[model samples]
Target chain A: MSTSTNVRLAGLHARYQFVETVRVPIAVIGTTLFPTLSLLFFIVPQSFAQDPAAATAATAQLAVFAVMSVSLFNYGVGVAEERALPWDGYTRTLPAGPSPRLVGRLLNGLAFVILGLVPLVLLAWLLTAATLPPSRLALTAAALLAAGFPLFAIGIGIGYSMSTKAALAVAQSLLLPLAFGGGLFLPPETFPGWLNSISMWLPTRAGRDLVVTATTGVDLPGPTVFVLGGWTLLAGSLAVWAYRRDEGRRFR
Target chain B: MEILARTVQATRCYGPVIALDGVSLDVPAGQLLGLLGPNGAGKTTLLQLLPGLRRPTSGTVELFGGYPRDAARRRRLGCTPQETGLPPTLRVHEVVEFVAGHFADPVPTPELLEQFGLTGLERRQSGGLSGGQKRRLTVAVAFVGRPDLVLLDEPTTGLDVEARHALWDAVRRYHQGGGTVVLTSHYLEEVEALAERVVVIDQGRVRADGTLADVRSLVPARRVRLRAPDLPELAGVERSNRDGDRHELWTADSDALVRQLVTMGIPFRDLEVATASLEEAFLALTAPGTQTVALIDGELAR
Candidate 1:
């Protein structure tokens, strides 16, 4: 009826979705574990950890990767699985409209992204010479979260357009390439000539450069903000298109 | 009576398959209407149109005298589709409460659960509940918003007899309290039990629509059951099916058949003549080439 009530209902939906996923625990553990383990085993004991700037940059890059992975899997695979259920149909027909449900899902994705970062951040602090000032740490968190927008949009688009099995495979296939090609797994400085040039325009690369800049004071050589913003706009449009396509096919 | 929902020559197509073909109907306020049809008889499709879950390919569907797609109008409508899967991880109470939150004034969650006989399972996860319990919960959630109109698509489909009766009782209570309900079921007995008004649908068309008695009168055939050592061909018997040694004959005039049997002095024993049940009436009405359109027109004229 009222806008306040609608907002409250959205909050309730978010809480319900969050609780539903948290109860399973395995999904959360699985998404967050890989990045944390990668940091611990691969980056911590290496000579890179001895270099403060390199370790800090690597830590920030992995943290962004963790957020991207959670967003893609949680939104993409989760939405596809939900669409297959009758409960989703019931909710869609409710008079509350799609805003509350979409907002609730985004909130759930945000919660997982934050949860996914905790382990990585803790390992980076305890095991490596990586360091960030309190201000830079806060800025880096904001930048990493901002970087998740495109990933979330992409995930939602995939979820709406594909079946659960297809969404899972597609998200996985897209995740590794984006991470590697965007210079998340390796520093962009070490990337070969072609990849290094291509990585500057990729969303994942834009996200990593934004986070790295925020944390390490590295001046971005390319238009990092424009690249990230462009991807966000494109992915957002794709997400909206996918949702309408699904609704048209299923409900109309 | 005020009409709560109406469909005028509505037709729906799913790819090449026609689900609801030129079906016209009206649901009055406070009327418990039963849609009786076999599986894939377009009952679910019609129900979905009323709640704005699906749009018609042609013609129009209206709720509260407005387009069914209007969200403001749909706020007063509630529906349960044929298959509902609850989120497995949430406890039953949480699910109920979450759905209830969407309404302006929702019934208390515990009271609604009690009404549906789900009080004891409030703490259990929905996935852990039995199929019957889940069905009951699904039906109960449809009433949480205290909607003026509720559409239930095969609410007791997978429930046991006891569960079905419980759901019927709950539905009867709601109807008595002045709630309008339109439910679909393949079970003729269910419609006879719960609906004051019955609509029989077949091949995506309304073959019969009227009060139960009115529908029954459309097919006036009486069933005659008898056993004999040897049987001769009967002239008036329209159709007959054998069950063991007894033969069940459907005839338009049972009295004439009985009188003829007496006059002919046929050696027949254990003779029985009875009015057709709703199931038989439905079969006769839906039987191919039975002039269903004429029968429906005749009923509407009265």
Candidate 2:
């Protein structure tokens, strides 16, 4: 848990320590979202323009999907590929072992968290007819980051547990369901009773709740933030375990 | 340091196949140990235990007086593993710098380049170099931190006679600097040049450990090839070959055996004594446990 040993960090010495991982994958997530979200907002708007409220909600739904695409899908693939590189092999052999190594990765993850959120914020601003309160925008970003942290951990775990192909599949399959149940796409009040009740504990629900509260001055109870933080912590631990497991088994 | 880089005891079984059967040996620091086993003889597996790259299913491996955890310990060790790997796009200076960054007092780049004959190639990328040049570059990195101990498993994998001789000089310089070198190679000459002491490991067990002359003393000295008009059958000899009137006798000591043959009035055409080489002596030491008796007869059977 505390990787404070003085093992040297070898092979991959990055110039920008905080943003190394973000440097590559953020471009991947950002570019992928640009075209997809752009098409949804510019092209599909004609279909739902008659109902402005529906259009607004649909645009909001698209932004949530973009978050899912990058955080869970692209981030998982990036982390897995990094592990498989021989550069990582050289890094481990260094005298100052895993201590400096994990620090680099953790710092990089937080940077990506910021990189991943920026585009979604800009898209949210562009898609809304009447700007949601600035306070709402700020809350939405914070909530997305809080919610995404655990999913990033879970994504990293999946990346290690499965082959590259399998990790990608798991990421994509879980994205829609996670977003839908979290109350990002449609209000949880409109969901079936049992589904709405269960959604309260899910990361997506807490994330959407935080965002809604920030935007509309509608706060979900403070307990919701704790549940979301708990998810992130649990997933973070699992990711570390998954990484060690996969590396130990791969001898060649 | 008198510390064991790795020690394996009774380690065995690779899935259902047995790799090391009660194989126990200590790798003392500060000397080159030759892992002298034929293909599938488990030499690679034995070295893998040192860096904590592979775990023995039943034994222990210690590096610098502690259990090996990962490559970090190996980073402190210089192992020219069977595979001398480097990225294609990496320039020679980059490779040196990369490993240098991991250490506190890395060997000076210009000094190492000049010593290893890599001065001009410092600007060149590793992938574009010849096989021998690549091996040289890899060795340069191995000694980057002037590691606690250097383990060279098949060190000169790609060099010719000239380059190998150059490498031997570099190895000697490393030792002269008070650093220890552990070298292993199929080229007995390289082993002869690098290893101050030798340990022959066959089938994951140490068959012999001592100086080259000391181990050579364990096996026979000279092999006698002869042609005689009247050949009295030699008794107690392991093998005798006959072609037409020529009789070639393979024996442990050529001087004593040849004197006896001459005294017997065995008038022959020709007789010559061939001095025992390291390969010859190694075969004899590892011969008994060998499932194939090929090394026993030397080239006679083949």
Candidate 3:
């Protein structure tokens, strides 16, 4: 097939997969509601809402949390479950090759990540004094999406390497630690010295720092970009290795 | 005839278990070949190799004069694995259209569905279909691309009699249009009904391969029964057993055995001669050891 045809097929795959995921109401609700409910129950009731800087930063942290959750769950758990299906195996044998499906899955992940942010963004805007200039907000959104790459890679790695049940457990176990350690729930200003030093190296922390800086004009540490880039490179490599290993194990 | 696909001394192993052992076969274009085998006969393994779903442990498998794994070579091929689950949420037509999008030229969705008796089920989710309905749809999806060759692994497994015939007719239509097909089935009747040529596999080896009558003729041993008080030694009698006054004998030449009985003047009455059915032939060919298989091969060689 020509390049244009392949691209069109990839788009079709993405649209169908997205439709499949959304038809199951629980999947959509589970992905979007968890983070939005967190904001409603925790941040809106707190006295810190009166402070614009703290509230804005808090909202930014939660927004990053939403994106991370969607990326991890949608790719890690989603891919693992799909891999177990015979239909998936059949699709892998098609002449169109894996690139179209891979492209489609990535696009689907991005769509869910954005979907997960909608509720959180609406609640944050309505309930708190948290605010950002439209241009800054757009920059922050771009930064958040960019920062999601490493997490998406990690999710793909988990999805490809483990069985569905194991992937679910791993994704769940990784979520809270990464969130807390990255100062998503509580800003890095409050962590003890050792924890703060360790947080600087984590992908989540790197992503959170970069997005927060983009949103609030906070000065980012010198190593944030490098840390994010390194994780993306490492995780991307792991994902590829896992995918090939899976193909070898199942098909060869 | 041109060969569309072939495996030269292909061997496949799942860890220590040899699923297919030193097996070689050629699939010619536009032939509807039935793969008849008991469970664990490596039938599924052979089908998987053709579509590049699994590579042989050793030896070469070629499709369209290229490696089976090559995407370009698979363009003309369609396949349905033994069992598959469709996405629960997608309507039947949606699934067909999604697969059709991959091909340059595809059968129209409505036409394909109608051919498979899935016309009214177009808007229904696959998860809502009955077992037979789901099976029909699974098979129907393979033809959506209008592929030149289709590998169907037990395509009508869970269907009722009516549904199975529907699927068979659909397959026949494809074959009549010059499409090549290789299907595996536990139903001898199915093979007898649809296949022009049959290949019987057992214990990871090809036990028999020929036209329907040729395979049935592999075990030419006939069963002869008679009532007699005394019997003379007979030529061409493979084995003999006595049950009271009634003697039973197995021989390759029932006519010669009968002649010997009459000439010997053994006071025999109520004599009966019966040829083996295809089922019996299959069992004889696939029997536990290499004895029957070796005999058949020797006969074929002669």
Q: Model 3 segments beyond 4 Å from truth?
A: B81-84, B221-275, B291-299
Looking at model 2 chain B, which ten-residue stretch has the lowest summed lDDT? Answer: B293-302
For candidate 1, lDDT tens digit of each residue in A33-70?
88888888879878989888999999988988888888
- Residues B80-145 of candidate 1 have per-residue lDDT tens digits of 733347898989999888888878899999899999999889899988988888888889989999
lDDT of each residue in A176-227, candidate 2, tens digit only: 6887787665667679989977887887677666655555555466678888
User: TM-scores for all candidates?
Assistant: 0.93, 0.73, 0.91
Decreasing TM-score order of the candidates: 1, 3, 2
Q: Over all chains combined, what TM-score does candidate 1 have?
A: 0.93
**Tens-digit per-residue lDDT, B1-302, candidate 2:** 48657575747567787666555566565565566766666776776666666677887778877867754555567655222356555677877877777676888998888878889888786668888887887777778887878767676777887878888888887777766666667777677666766666676666666677766655456667777665776654556667887776666766777777778777765677787677776777677655432221112121
| CA RMSD, predictions in order | 2.6, 6.3, 3.2
Task: Give the CA lDDT, 0 to 100, for residue B187 in model 1.
Answer: 80
Evaluated on chain B only, candidate 3 has a TM-score of 0.84
lDDT of 2 at A225: 81
Model 3, B264-299: lDDT tens per residue?
A: 888988999997556767877787774434323225
Candidate 3 lDDT, tens digit per residue, A148-193? Answer: 9889888999999999999999999999999999888888898999
Error of 2 at A211 (Å): 4.6
Best by TM-score: 1
